[model samples]
Target: MNLFRAASLVSFLTLLSRITGLVREQMVAAMFGASAVTDAFNVAFRLPNLLRRLFAEGAFSQAFIPLFAATRARDGDAATRDLLDAVASVLVAVLLAVSILGVVFAPVLLWLMASGLQAEDQALWMTRVMFPYILLMSLVALAAGVLNTWKKFVVPAATPVLLNLSMIACAALLAPWFRRHGIEPIYAMAVGVMIGGVLQLAVQLPALWRLGMVPRLHLTPGGLRRSWHHPGVRHVLRQMAPAILGVSVAQISLLINTQLASHVGPGAVSWLTYADRLMEFPTALLGVALGVVLLPQLSAARAKNELGQYSQLLDWGLRLVLLFSLPCAVALLLFGEPLVAVLYHYGAFRPVDVAETVVSLQGYGVGLLGLVAIKVLAPGFYAQQNLRTPVKIAVAVLVLTQLLNIYTVPRFGQAGLALSIGIAALCNAGLLLTGLLRGGLYQPQPGWGLLVLRIVIAALLLAGALYWMQHHWSWLTLPKGQRVAIVSGCLAASVGLYFAALALLGLPWWRMLRRAAL
Candidate 1:
């Protein structure tokens, strides 16, 4: 398999999802603006989103994929298929119970997450309405694991576009209708979340069926009990134990940050969320794309006892993160205000909101490389079936993050929350890389020093150009059409200059498309 090709395919598909996601965010910002209601919505959505990450895509996938790949390698397709059924059965039963509890305790969860929410009733209602989203998304995650193991990356990568589109439609069509009917427009977004969740899972079924790998879930009580006792299920649960803690540490940081942001001000949660939307462009395009493509292949390599190939995979992923993410980090730091203004400043989205979001965007940029690096680095331990090491690193980082937050949050506000997370991510990534090297699990390839020098040089050039454009343009004062046009042109030029500089420096950037074969 061509790792570059697979990763590119996932990246391209993810680009579509992120683009539509930005559009969704733009609509939300235009209609809702940065207010207590928007904060309520953001906080409410985080409930299911948190659990989805903690259980589904985070610990579950981290545990399941490596084992799933190894099972296929050692026991063949028939055994793997049976393993899938057992896992799916157990996952479904748990999801059903969790969703019910979330709905029943929506108020308690919302208060715990964001006690400062002004629109508590709206948030509670929306939380109940959207909590089941975790059930659907968890199933989608299961399907994604199965499809990725089969090297079917497109559907899994593309399904998120459906979610984005659903929200766009709701914000466009349903929001106004709700206002006319004397209902809060924000509730439309909750309905969109559910619709999007259903569509996302619905789309995955066909892809799973095409591979003849659709899991036959056991829905009955007896069947669920039997599936829970399955050996493969037990092994996955064991793997998920430390994996869950690692993911939980990160989520706990987010929860604490959200609680902090809520108390800071009304718009803090929404501001951070809008900035997060912009940040996702680089993260999803590079970090997530590479992580998804690398994990299965890394596990396969480990299964065959190919230590060299495993090290090479990690090296390739890290080099790509540095090469691409540095330029993105530069853009975010130097060009964030213009980007935020151009993308989000419309209708109810005031100039002040643009300014607020830019701060968070730049704060996140401070660790874009590390944030992306962790996506690749953590998987090294996960693929080695060693989840505890990353968990320990994560727990320490969690403490460090809160300690930094004590000083930064008081001074920087929501941006301080963003900064703390960014610094902690850098610490986390550094420790993970060190762990990998100390264990001899990963050996750095030659030319890393030269690669870093080239990336730094090119990033500086990009930063200089972007800084000039940012100062020259009146992004906040310009008319909408002019702002969009100039920002688009400047972005194009910046990208061109970054690549041109790399080429002039003898970096061979195009060779990325030819590297990382599995």
Candidate 2:
């Protein structure tokens, strides 16, 4: 499949996953609300997720996918499997060691993430119980990278539904069981996480076996020695180390946000996580799904020395991301409160929680464009086998984000935490784009200025419409059924009106989007 078609398929699956994820979040919020227990679960879950993003999605994909694609294109299956086996062997060995240490020093990790919270021990205990999720998810990411390389997009894209289902089931079923036994339901949630991680890995294994590319674990020293010394494996290791440092710096800022929010008060961390999750709905749907589809295409383009196609592909990805991400961000800013209230206000969630969450959600919405840009831009560097540039930028972004937090947190509280991330994301995206242009690796297509203007105009109109509708209805005071019905109508109208505005401005996407199919 071409980039657009492949991306659309991935996006559709991701939309499904994100919808399920929202349901999962709704269940969790209803059960635990944004209290200390939920806050602890967020920290524990985030510890693994942070590493998963850094290693699985960041370092591993940056290093592994290009080489794997090239190997498959040139040397065929045997050679590709050799590279896969070698990488898998080393990955398992290292992640196992890290997981052991994480579990052993779980308190240290918690102390780092939640030192200011008076009940740090609660989150710390959960972190220990859930720490091994890192090991399970690392393998899952490796499997996903392999599947995407083979053009098996649907399975990898749909894998997260398993996680959402696992969490939802545990929250609904096992939470009560744990409560009956005088245990915090959060512990059941943690156990659900480990089980979900395992299920995610299991689903992908059969696909690999079918492709004749399932990696055989070789944990013995001789096995590790043989794998690590290969020239291809060594090159992968070299790229991965720098790439890890690059993404690790950005993740550090998030952990810092967690720590700072922990100090702010109860539910601050939960608030930040909730707001971030809502933002992820669009980021995952567009930027992330496109990133997943683009890398293999980019890698193949570079391998064939098709620089023009590479530039065109990058330009298309960026334009599409900006076109969709901007309006979505605006919608979040315009409708955050009602969205949060309808989705989460129940059981233990109070009015104040919704109000604070809306503030942070808007803050995060400001950086949505930047966050999406980085997904497409970073891969531009990675596919070219240049990891150092992003690492440098990431380090700078890390400092910038922390400095912003230092200034913002004292006055803004949870909103400050979210704002720091948004500002840093914008800065990071700008630097990445600058480096790409200066390096001459990505040449901007003509008509960018005009295209951007049309998007801006349409977004402004859409925002205005949404703002008017938000005030027109007292959404929160209505019955639950009425609230859902009105919100759905408003959302549909917002999207339809935005597209109509774009069409009126002579930027009809239906025709243009199909051209991107090639």
Candidate 3:
């Protein structure tokens, strides 16, 4: 497929998954509120998710895909099949071992990540109940990498929808049972996660089967030992080690936030979780969609020594992210409270919960551009097999996060944690962009500066218009009206204002749209 077609497919599927996820989060907020149970669930869910990113999505894909692509290109179908079987064999054994360890030491792991939670036996119990999801999801990750290599982006991208669907079902149907029975609803959520992982893995099976790449059980090493000796695999490993570490730095920021939130108050962790869900809507829809679709194309181009195509593709990806993300960031900053109120204003979630969550969401929204930039740029380094730079930068950002957490948490509470993370993301993105420029891998195309200027102007105008509407409509004063009027109005005005400003600035929204169409 062409680059635009590939990106469109990925983006459309990701947008669907993100919308379902929003609905799921809304259900969660309504049922659980910003409470201790929600906090426990967040910690439990994060543990598996962090590992999923670190090993499954981040390191494994970075290391596996380039080699997989090479194998597909040079060695043909047999070689690819053998490689898949061998890798699958090793992966199952490794994931099983890790899962056993996690189940056995669930409490200890929870304590280390959220030390303050050690005092709360309830949190520990919920964590143990949810810990087995790590194994199921690791397997799912491997399957996803295999699918991505096959250029079957649709299934893997759509798999996340299963997770949200499962959670929503549990929250809407099963949560009441737990509540009436006096059992923690968090346990139900944990069970939903395990089921979600299973479904995620299962959904990809049909695609794999159609590709004739279904991996069979093989205790023997098969091509696995050869993969260890393959020069391409070795190169991938070399790049992946540092990339994994770098990715972990982002996860570390979340872990630290959770740990600190655990100490802040009863629902601080939940508040942060709620805010992050809002932030992730745009990040996943635009940033992750671009990164996942672009990386493989970039890697293939780099392999073929087509530096110009690689650079152009990266540039296009960045432009796409900026076009969508900047305006979304602006809207988030202006209407965070109204958005939070609309999504999470029911059940046990109250106006106070809305207030705290909005503060965190705005803090996070401030760094949304940087967060998306990191997603778009890191893949450039990974595609080039240079992971150490990102790792070093990540470590530096981690140190900054710690320092800020220490200084800010005492005064600003949950908002401080969010701000620290946002600042660190900006730092990481800046370093990545600098490195890309220094390596001469990125150059501004003609009119690039003018395009960026137009984007900035449009975003500012949209923000201003939203601000005016919110004040004149008294959006904050009318709680019920604020939910519908503020969110819908801000979104509508931002869309109109941004596009109108872009037109006024002579940026060809139509031409660009036509190019995307073509």
Candidate 4:
């Protein structure tokens, strides 16, 4: 499949997963509210999620995919199968060790991540209950990387839907019974997470079997060790170490937010979590979709020393990201409160919670553009096996984020945490783009500058129009029916205004769409 088509397929599936995830989160907020249980659950979920990214998604996949792709290119299917089995064997063993350690030391881990919480025991309980998820998910991630190499984006992207579905089912059907039996609903959610991970891994097995890529169980360390000596594997590892650090740097900003939120009043973590969920909707659907689809293509092109193709893919990816991301960012900034209120204002999630969460959501919205750009740009380095550059930049941004947090959190509370991360994302994006240019892997074509200028202008126009509508009209403040109408109207108007601006500025939306469609 072509880059655009691949990205579209990933994006569509991702959108479905994200929407379902939003529903699952809404259920959690309604049932748990922004209290100790919610905070504990949030921290618990984040801990495993952090590791999943660190080992599986961030470092492992970065290392695995390029070499896997290269092996496919040079050798035949058997070579690829052997490499996969070797990697899978090592992956399962390593993750099992890690999961066991996590189960044994859940309290210490929770204490470190959320030190400010007074309810340390509560936190530890949730962590212990949820930590097993990391093991299941890491395996899922390994399977996902294998699938992505086979150009099977659907199953991997769709796997997240199982997670959301599991959580939603548990919350809707099982939570009440658990509560009646004097059990905490959070435990039920924890169980749901473990089940979700199993389902996620299971869903991919059929696809692997179909491709004749099913990994065989092998306990021998030599097979995996051979990967270290292979040139492609060495190159991937070299790229992954820095990419891991780079991704970790970005994650530190989030870690700071989580820590700072813990220090704030009750419900702070939930509020931040809710805001993040909303922001992630667009980022996951657009940014992640592009990143996943672009990396293998870019990696293969770079392996063949095809700089022109790599550069073109980067260009196309950036344009497509901007095309969708810029408008979504604008919409979030404009209607953040209304969106938050609509999705999560029912049951235990009171109006006050909505108000607080929306503040953080809006702060996140302000940095949405930078966040999306960082997602689209960082893959370029990883594709070229140049992970260290992004890592250094990420560490710098991490320090900056913490410094900002130290200064801002005392003054602005949880919202300040969001603001600090947003600023850090902007800095991170600038550094990534600068690194790309300095490395001579990415440079603007003649129309590139003009295209960006037009996008900015269109965004500005849409923002102005939304601002006026928000201030001059009371539509957003209306009841449910009218509120939906008003939000929908604002969305339509903003979209129309942006497209009009694009056309007026001589941007080729139709041509881009046609190309993407083809």
My TM-score estimates for the predictions, one after another, are: 0.99, 0.98, 0.93, 0.94
Write the candidate numbers in order of decreasing TM-score.
1, 2, 4, 3
lDDT of each: 0.93, 0.86, 0.78, 0.80
- Which candidate leads in lDDT? 1
Candidate 4 lDDT by residue in tens digits, 1-518: 66677878988999899899999998998888888888888888899898888888888787788778767877878888877776777677777889889989987878777877766676677677778787788778878877887788899999999999998998898889988999776778878888898899899899989998888856557765664455554555566677777777766666767877888977898898999999998888788988888787777888889898777777777787778788888877776766876788767988889888878887788778788888789888877767778778888988998898888788878988888878888888888888888888986656777888989899889888877776665533468677777777777877888999999999987666433221
Task: Give a tens-digit lDDT track for model 2, residues 1-518.
Answer: 56778888999999988888888888888888888778888888888788877877778778888888878888888888888899999889988898899888888777787776665666777788788887888888888888988899988999888988898888889989988999877788888888888899999999989998889878899999998897788999899889989878877877888888888888998888788889998999889988998888888888889999899888988989878999999988999987998898887888888899999999899899999999899989888999999999999989888888888888899898888888888999999999999988899998889899999999999989989988888766778888888889989999999999999999967654553443
Q: Which residue pairs show backbone clashes in model 3? A: none
On the 0 to 100 scale, the lDDT of residue 302 in model 2 is 85
For candidate 4, the per-residue lDDT at 305 reads: 91
Candidate no. 3 TM-score: 0.93
lDDT per residue for candidate 3 within 52-158, as digits (tens), equals 77877878777777667667767888987877776676666667777778778887889877876533566676666666676667667667767776778899899
Model 1 pairs in collision = none
Worst 10-residue lDDT window, candidate 2? 509-518
| Tens digits of per-residue lDDT for model 1, 195-256 | 99999999998888887888998989899888999999999999999999999999999999
Q: Which candidate is the best by TM-score?
A: 1
Between prediction 2 and prediction 3, which has the larger lDDT? 2
Q: How far is candidate 1 from the true structure (C-alpha RMSD, Å)?
A: 0.9
Superposition TM-score, candidate 4 onto the true structure: 0.94
| Model 2 regions more than 4 Å off | 515-518
Off by over 4 Å in 4: 220-239, 472-477, 513-518
Ranking of models by lDDT: 1, 2, 4, 3
